[model samples]
Target: MAVRMEELRDHEAVRAVNRAAFGGGHGETVAELVAALRRDDPGALSLVAEEDGEVVGHIMFSRTLLDAPRELVPVQTLSPLGILPQWQGRGLGTALIRAGLDEMGERGVPLVFLEGDPRYYSRSGFEPAAGLGFRKPSLRIPDAAFQVFRLPAYETWMTGTLVYSDTFWRYDCVGLR
Candidate 1:
């Protein structure tokens, strides 16, 4: 499997993957949020996992801010990582995340935040954000699920409550209260 940055033409396919990956009742909402993020955030990154020309997974990272007492810190948030049902256990999701993080790192992004299983994300260097004085932007997200990965350029003193893009709240997606 090859992981690459999503192109303009891959929007519909990416939406389909997100919808299917989160199928029960949250599919459309998640897909809609992805679309909104793409449209609204110029710094947002969308990536797709390709296997022999078929898109098997998708992930996104959008610009966010950390509301520190003194200043706003720029960061990114990883959300809605989706892998086709059949491809779930094949490491496609991991590959997509790793590739996206590498891209963000190269772009000088200082941090990446997310709400996910610590057991899984920890493998990719994520740690509980609360331990580092990072707070969730929403009360809906429990402390345990809130995690962050500080890139090489991150400063040790950077810590505060996260502030997601308005698109996140507007779409009523995972990050909202």
Candidate 2:
């Protein structure tokens, strides 16, 4: 099957993919965030994986700000990468991740942050943010689960408590921790 990056249409179909992928909790809100980001910040990267006119997977990157020692710095956030259960082992998630990173890299996005499985995200070059002076704003989150990927090199410039957009807070991403 071919994987391509394109603007996501068919809101209901995207929602269905999310519902099926996450069993009503995660997917539904992730789908909604995708639409909301598109409406509010159309430039935010929203990509979908389609095969035979059906969306099998989705990944979202949105604007996020880092609270640096001096001031708030803008960065892209990679989150909520969801793939339908049936497509779990097919490497669609990896492809979407690569596409997202490549797109961000080309744009010179300084950093990308995510909260996910260390074992899996490590393969994509993510490391614990705290190790590089970045700390999670929420003391509740374990330091290990919060990770960052700096394009050129990890440095003090990227250190800060990550501030995600409001849409992410609307959903319960407990599974992320």
Error of 1 at 30 (Å): 0.7
- Model 2 TM-score? 0.87
TM-scores, in order shown? 0.95, 0.87
- Report the lDDT tens digits of candidate 1 across residue range 54-158: 888999999999987768989999998999898899999889889999999999999999999899999989999999989898888878889999998898778
Q: Report the error of model 1 at residue 46, Å.
A: 0.7
- Flag regions of model 2 displaced more than 4 Å: 8-10, 153-155, 172-177
lDDT tens readout by residue for model 2, 41-78: 66788678888988888777888888888888788888
Provide the lowest-lDDT 10-residue window in model 1. 168-177
Off by over 4 Å in 1: 175-177
Q: How much is 112 displaced in model 2, in angstroms? A: 0.5
Per-prediction count of colliding residue pairs? 0, 0
- Candidate 1's TM-score reads 0.95
